[model samples]
Target: MGGVVERTDLGRGDDPLIGRVLDGRYEVGQKIARGGMATVYQARDLRLDRTVAVKVMHSGLADDPEFVSRFEREARSAARLSHHNVVSVFDQGDDRGTLFLVMEYVPGLTLRDLIRKDAPMDPGKALELIEPVLAALAAAHGAGMIHRDVKPENVLLADDGRIKVADFGLARAVNAETQHTATGGVLIGTVSYLSPELVVDGKADARSDVYAVGVLLYEMLTGVKPHQADSPIQVAYKHVHEDVPAPSLREPALPAYVDALVARATARDRDLRPSDARVLLHQVRRVRQALDHGVVEDPELYADLMPGVRPIAEDTGEVTGELEREDRISILGADDVYDQDREVTTAMPPSGVATAVPPRPPQNLAHNQPPRVVPPPVVADEPRRFQQPKRSRRGLFLLIGVLVTALLVGISAWQLGRYTTTPSVISLSQSAAKAKITKAGLTFKLGKAEYSEKYTKGSVMDTDPAPGDKVSKGGTVTVILSLGPERHAVPTVRGKTLEEVQQLIADADLSLGEVTQAYSDLVDEGMVVTTDPKAGTLLKRDTAIDVVVSKGPKPIDITDWTGKSAKQAQKSLEKQGFKVTVDEQFDDTITKGKVISQTPNTGQGVKGDEITLVVSKGPELFAIPHVRGLRTNDARQKLEDAGFKVKVHHSSLFVGANYVVTVSPGEGTMVPKGTTVTINVV
Candidate 1:
């Protein structure tokens, strides 16, 4: 309805849309692969100039309104998931009834290819591969979404050493619309991987994904499928009725914990299995670590991972007829005992859906006789004419012991099933945390609010028993909500080193913003002088506070102010934060009040250092030697001898320049030593 719903035939013929562009962006190239309902093509994202995977739905599916609606929902769900181990969905489009989804193109083989070539792989290598798949599912589960279909076909091993899980919400779309494993009499999913719940009720959750992964793991450990039948429907029936067998049956070398891990994951009782993929992933990592360390016996790990109920029969494999007749007979009861519904037939159905069916008589068995696949055929009941009187005491005793042991095991398993671990819900919203806790069959109780810097306000901060701790299914889980970060006074950073203050800031739950340098007389170099907003200021945790660090005392440069005005020198030096000292002296050639000398006038000086200046005073005055009536040359000579420059001038009258008529500065006059004197000649 939102976009074009495909109506063309892409079902069973050469695709005509090959090499054609779709949505003006994704250039659909050649078909890479095709499945029952969709065809995959290697396409190029023209806008991004990168290769991507385009999956186009078949004709019947794309044309149906119900399927199209579900398809849109699936696209939104798949696009919401983002993880390193998940194939990212980029876009969803419909171009002229051709529905397609764009996804990250992984250039590598699928897990299916790996299993086809090198199945029954080493336990370590199998775990190494499956670990990433679980991580991807875990992310989806954490986001409140489920990957309904989990199988080897969806796991891609990229050439760049990345394992990505694909096709999220695809099964959900089909399942929601069809509500069965078969659509239009065609099988949609591989029946071998379906869980008991999925096979019976067509319902699934995170545990269903875990069950499929368990089956996947078993196939890796063994080279064949665990259950075999004449038809896919029979296999689905076996999924609901039988328990998945331990891998050790195929590979005896596998540790007990490995079997326990698989058993717990694939347990028919979903409650006994891990709550979700994340919980299962944790257990897988623990087991993998143990295997890596070569631990032969880890009772604790084995106990934790082992399924509450011990199943004596049922197995999965890649190929059919993996177990012989004798093996089958020893594992389960006769087929006739499974016949509960009289209307249903055990024979393979054409529709391929798993339905409870009456057990069919084996062709190889004698006429009118039940199957002997569960136990050894001790009595060949050939319709004997006469019956022999029967039983020995030993046989009776053996039967009694078997009944008692099975009863004890059943009771113990029921008790064990009641226990499940508390899942990690830290930093999740209060409603979300409660939903998950309750979904695990546990009760929820809100506890006191606590302050935490890591968690946000009203989000889950802590749990009473803590996550990963075992609790009864109906037991109450108390959650503490975060009250946000607590406020504290800024620490004392004055006179402390940068490193020390940084540590102090962290300890106080505060972060360092910017560090500035300043010259302080009291603080040493490379030490904190003060802090922005000063010290002892109350602030929230992780708040960035600016700091001021010291670069030692300020250095003052002496400008050598000699021969400059003493008043000007003192005033200019004081303005630069340096103390000024002045001394007075008399000089013959220098100005009377100008700076005559300075002390230590060169190089660098410390802050608050004193600068000295010497002021000039007038020179001593002596009698001018009264040169009136004396020869002009004699008067000039007398004035020049006294360090004073003398100038000669004649009177207005035409008298010979023999004597000085009047002498300027005639008598004693106080002046500087370099003062000039004028004389007149008659």
Candidate 2:
């Protein structure tokens, strides 16, 4: 009500509705403005891709079905009057029992801001700004709708230089309900602009809006409110009994007719004022015309603006302000004015018409008498307010009244305020929910908390006896709070068996998913190596965790290299990541430098294992023994001893038995180790 989002305070995190998306369409953002009655929020219309302003009603009013019904009904009525000067109502909704209204977001400042900057402004300038406001009101009045709340805060000055009226029919929606006193004896609506009749009886029509505009005009001219008092109650008291002073008292340069315009509109009696905004707009144009003509002395226009029948204050025009709360009936603290049913100052009859004011209750009555509230003075033609009815008429009315009272009591016995219904508190904070329950005369019971993904931690998740359910007076209301989402840390399962790993996962509140086996030299066969998500990861309940298991050292088949080229074998084995070594030995039949045998040639080994190849180095060589000129028998014995086969031959020139000759094969020759030598005899 104070203004829109442009010049508002920065958003706060504690406001529950700050980040909420209503009806899955409007993303409610920051707090724009806070007033006595409602909160305004900057929001985005996700569907339309535009910004909007959302007005959220207080919990006390939103929870009231009767108030909600009136609000919705009046909202629909306001939406029908599509004036460029009026702020458009885009939609109205109840999101989880938090009632809100979406309206066009005008980016600029409020008239309140303008007033703060340029009060005591030129009359023509003031008229220029207010003329559009009156046109807006005139259109609504033409549509037979009354804007019960009209004030500077509800008027917007756009960045594009357009003036608009906002929150139409909102005050009427609040006032149309049975007049009820809110907590702390607080009043409703902006107090400075409240009409005398509205303060007196909580009733308003088009003329009431005219009165507020009159107040606006007066403040614009004088730069101050007409009434001043110690408290809001005192201000309301003055609206009822005092008259609004002329603006000329503050600024003497003004013509008297301007004074008359303010005086006539702010007249204590509604009958003396213009019937509606249209009538007032016509009068304003006449005054503007006179001002344009520079007609300083127009007693004719003055007389026309202020008839002789109406009374105008010629007081000092001193500004009246201390603490102005709600602009309604001032009967407060003391019993200045009151009646039964604290909800409303003036009680209504079945016909929906306000009854005549009851006589003020006697103060300091007999000790045995109960207390009574003094009622406001009634609007009546008769002067003798204390006059009693005739005895005969009184007797007949009393008998019927007694019977009606008895019947009403008998019918209302079941309820009769003996119980209260549970308020809608879903999604509210725990403290806030508890406050509502306790305020409704129900006990606050905290049930077990639960993990919830939808609700924030420490906020209410659910409730027993639910919203709108009737509960016995002082009955306990059980509420469940959110503990946030469920999560657990995955346990370490490496080096564990399959059964052990499954048990560990289950203990961690996780499910076992696919299990894979891999070769691990360190871990034993069929043992878990590690988990896929790894150990110590925080995961939601029942989330499947995959694991890797060890199948022990892998087996590698070695190729047999016996009787093969040793160089080729070494190359093949080394290329396959195996370390190779060689061994050589002389052989009689194998080729030189060929493989004789391989160690563990048929066994299996993993990669990086060692392989041994035995290669052939060819046959051994020896020198033949020298047996020339020796006895043949001796030579033969010596050849046999030298590991060779001996042969004896007697030549034709042989010496005789045991004679020696040159050996056939030359002695001292390189030959095979088993080569034979022969000696000749003559």
Candidate 3:
């Protein structure tokens, strides 16, 4: 077969075993998901007796020396960092040649999956979803780590519904190192979430991460993307050319504040946008809080405009409905029955009286009776004449009081609207629940069913609001549904010890239904040879299973080795996989070349064991040289050079053995080389 490609499997399948020792220490379990670089598996750590996710590179990639080294190094770096939000890297090693990274296995769906099922969240809720992401990013940023990919796929939603960001530094490692082209081409990260700067320059900084997060926020607030295109490249172009549309445009009921937030986040000019995730997060949170209160945020500017700059034009007076009509009336000449009394005499009523009243005749109207007989000194009642007219005092006061009461009522109604409760739909089937909510004049959101042992499948477990609460129209309500009993993926129990294999099955929430033994040379005793259902196959709870174990390889007997030649002894020991060592010595009575003593006696040694031996050569033999009288020093030297020990019993006698007076082993005398020789004095 051709070389296999290395990658993480996002889909379900069997985890392919590579190298030797299928379950030397860890019991391989079910396949979780696959990524561009490695395939992650849910496995049991036999040593620690805990479950973990193992990410193993494909044999093809692991075989590549460069990729393996880089993978190991990157794993080490990621392992050093520990944060609540970051997925923890626990261990990395090469079992034989299959390189793998073991990390804390988180059991949860990804944000991408969450978004796929439900999206375009309510403004308040969307902000809640992303706030934790911002917090995680902040922690990573503080540590000088950038999460190059901040898309929903990289965000995991735990069972508690809290988001935990994953794959922070993994992308850098994958991209920095080239991959086999015909193999798993391109890295695993989703391309849609990439920032423009990352796409163009292949560089991602805190700002770039911030940009990606902004994109995610945009998608969450708006049901769709800021701009969606047929291809990734087209989407990228739109990101650059198109400004983020206000969410209110899609859902007009959305507050303007939310729309502005999306606009600022997806600003085409990176410089014009928030410089970092911290700033973006703060703004997003503020909008989220203010959304409920109807706060329309104002855009930030460099400076408050300097005031008091005199304007060229005067302020046009505010023209109310009444004022506007008055102006129109003046321009069109009042359609009244009479003009301003200037030509009143021309038009007379049936009573022969002009409709227009004549203006006062240039005289102060101080006199009570129009200056009664003006000649009779006009005594003026100036106070009453100059007093403001009170022709309709009662009617005006009643109108003013009614206007004030209406204003108060309108304000109270608005306050009541703000406090209305979110609606609820409980104990209904999925279709029924949706219908009821829609009929009640609210949007319906369907979430993935969480497996529950207590509730039956397709039944609603609970709703966001308790049943029978008063919620404002258009308010969102979340419902939890049941998927009956939880299903587990039966782990591949092949090549594992019986004890270890049982633990794996249990960790997967499966039962050790039965165990069966079998004889096999390839598998060790008590080790699982194979299992039914194989691995990576899903099974419902309480499913029965069978496991086969190895009895062990046949045993080998010891061989005897004595009185053998050195070469024969070495060869015979090696054939049985025993390490051999040799040492030679001289013997006085034994003939030449025979084994003397052997460790363990060689009769009881097992295969693959070690043995030591002491070998003996022929009897000792030597030649001696004799030296007569000479200089005392020279005589001693000659006697000693003849392979003999010179002794002086009584050196006081003129010249003792010190002058080599006589030699016991004389020159040319035949003697055993191993024999000791001595010379005597006087």
TM-score of each: 0.48, 0.48, 0.41
How do the residues 168-287 of candidate 3 rate in per-residue lDDT, one tens digit apiece? 556555544543332222322334455555533455577777777777887776656665653333444444334555566667777655655555555544664566777777877777
What C-alpha lDDT, on a 0 to 100 scale, does residue 391 get in candidate 3? Answer: 89
What's the number of clashes in each of the models? 16, 11, 17
lDDT by residue (tens digit), candidate 1, 1-682:
0111111233435668787899888888866665545777888877556688898887777896546645765676777686889997766767888888888788887787788789899989999999999999999999988777677778888899999998887766665555422333222345667777765555678998899899899989886666666544566656755667778887999999998888888887799889999999998899989999999889999888776643233322222322222111110111333322111111121222322332322322111122235554587667658779776699889999999999989998998898888887877899999999989888999998866444579998677656766688799999989877567688999988999999998787676767889999899999999987678987754456788999999887778888988888888788877888988877777878888889868988886788888888846566666777778788788878887888877678737867877767865765556677888788
Off by over 4 Å in 2: 2-7, 180-187, 310-682
lDDT per model, in order?
A: 0.72, 0.73, 0.57
lDDT of 2 by residue, 435-496 (tens): 98988888999998866544679997666665666678999899978887667788988788
Off by over 4 Å in 1: 1-13, 180-188, 310-355, 359-682
**lDDT of candidate 2 at residue 373, scale 0 to 100:** 42
Number of the top-ranking candidate, with lDDT as the measure: 2
